[model samples]
Target: MRSAFLIAPLLMMLSACAGEPTRMGASTKLVEAEEAILMPPPGSFSVAGITQKRFSNGLQQEIFLSTTSAVPGQNVVQMRLYGTRNDLRYRDDHLRFRTVTEAGIDAEMRGTLPGIPMKRSPYLVQNDYGAFGYAFGRPSPTELCMYAWQQLRTPEGEKPPFAGFGAVQIRVRICETGASERKLLAFMYGYSIIGAVDDMRWNPYGPPGPVSDRLGHSGNPIYPPEMTAGAEPDAARPVAVARPARRAVQPVAEPVPTALPGAERVVVPSPVRASSAAQPAANVAPASSAGGTIVPSPACVGANAATAAACP
Candidate 1:
């Protein structure tokens, strides 16, 4: 009776474990929940204090931080714009590329700043001329360029802009440099969403309802002289333009060297040459011998008793 009771409890414990799901069960549910939510509007927040930086090759980099309405001491958004530099400093060619046309902003964000939950797709964006190729953080059509935005989590121990407001929108614009050069330009904007503000969901640059007009324009809060200096020194030696490498010319094949003495020569038969005049056949029956007159021998006649002794 004691042994039966022990076996029943052990069997019941194993069944309970089989009914429960694994650790990944919770992650799968969260991903499904995130996909169902719609992206928030750009007009929900505002950004200010745009800054700038540049490379030696005249490439520009800018960063715009978000502005809060009532929330204090909270960095709701932080945007960075710069020439394409690998966030992974360990890469062989770090910061050598002039643009980030191929890099993913979401992956870049997660790598640079951890512990922040960001959306993967379906971001909100609007431009003045409607010339933007990509509204989301996806690559553009032509050069694989793109513009993207995502929601950022608010810091802990601080109240959000409003109730249920945990994320702030960050916008990034990467387009052509507009110069004759084929380089790219990047613009990032951070905005803070407050609940108390009117929930007017609209394109910020379309009608200029609430956001600032200088969203895309340059030359605002000009950079200091020292900060604007190029990466290369002013008095550095001029770099020589490198010419393309030329293909090696193949030499013409030369005749084989004259055969050494005692070397066996391959005797190839020469074809018979055609003559201007046709000649009579040499194999025809001859009428006379060249050396003397011809005569029939006894052997030419059928073998008889007299013919057998001598040829005709």
Candidate 2:
């Protein structure tokens, strides 16, 4: 009778435990989706597919596969976004290219697979949204690869812009065949965040700054320097006066008059040369001085007679 009572109590306890609902961890309770919440601008890339994993704690990871090829073998870009989450545990979580690359290599070597050697160098990437740490390498003669990561959160020692804390992590990996570095990095610079949490405090980007005081002020006009308030149309504007082209003046040759012993030497203008249609003129007439008349030397008769020998 005592053994039967003990067995009955144990059975009852087991049945009660089995009927209770079990709780799952936040990370393990994830819902799979296919919606695209983040993307680059239109025409920049063609989306092949999207995979989204939404966690129970309002965290989401979106992976995008993009086809950038026009022919058989072209560029391919893969982008991942860890949307802003209110959880503080993920605040310091960020991806590094070297660590991820080494992990991949080790996994391949452990599996007896050929490891791809990627020569990585620090690549600085500038973006309007935020700064990103990028690394690039050539895995093969025809394959180019780039990896970039970014973290957006409130700075240390600064209070949250709103009531709650928010953070975002972004990662991108792209490999293209015969693609230039600039072409591969264009996706990083041109991507945009289209999805955001409902709460205002969950903004990865802080509140917009105040408008400048100069804006809309009466004295501070926002027009180009060349554009006046009442400027005339280009066709109606006054035509600039074109000045007449000045002709170059030809130098007139002067004849050297023979020096007389008692009279001052005088310079006579050379006779103008006549065209072929007209008869040639005679030598210049002698110039009369106060003392007497002085005749020029024959050597200094023509326009070409400016030489010292002719003058002497």
Q: Write the per-residue lDDT of candidate 1 for residues 1-312, one digit (tens) a residue.
A: 999999999999998867433343221121221221122235432333333222221112233334321222222222322223322333242223222332566555444333334333333443322322223221222322333544333234333334322122344533221221112222322222221112332222223237676666776544446666345446878989999999999999998988687654343222221121124345323444244434444344465664343321
List ranges where model 2 is wrong by over 4 Å: 1-34, 67-125, 157-164, 223-312
- For model 2 the local lDDT of residue 83 reads 37
Q: Can you write out model 2's per-residue Cα lDDT over 38-124, one digit (the tens) per residue?
A: 576555666664544443234444454554432232232233333334343433444322223557544523232124344444555
Count: clashes, candidate 1:
9
TM of each candidate vs. truth: 0.20, 0.47
What lDDT, from 0 to 1, does candidate 2 have?
A: 0.54
lDDT, candidates in the order shown:
0.34, 0.54
Model 2 TM-score on a 0 to 1 scale: 0.47
TM-score of 1: 0.20
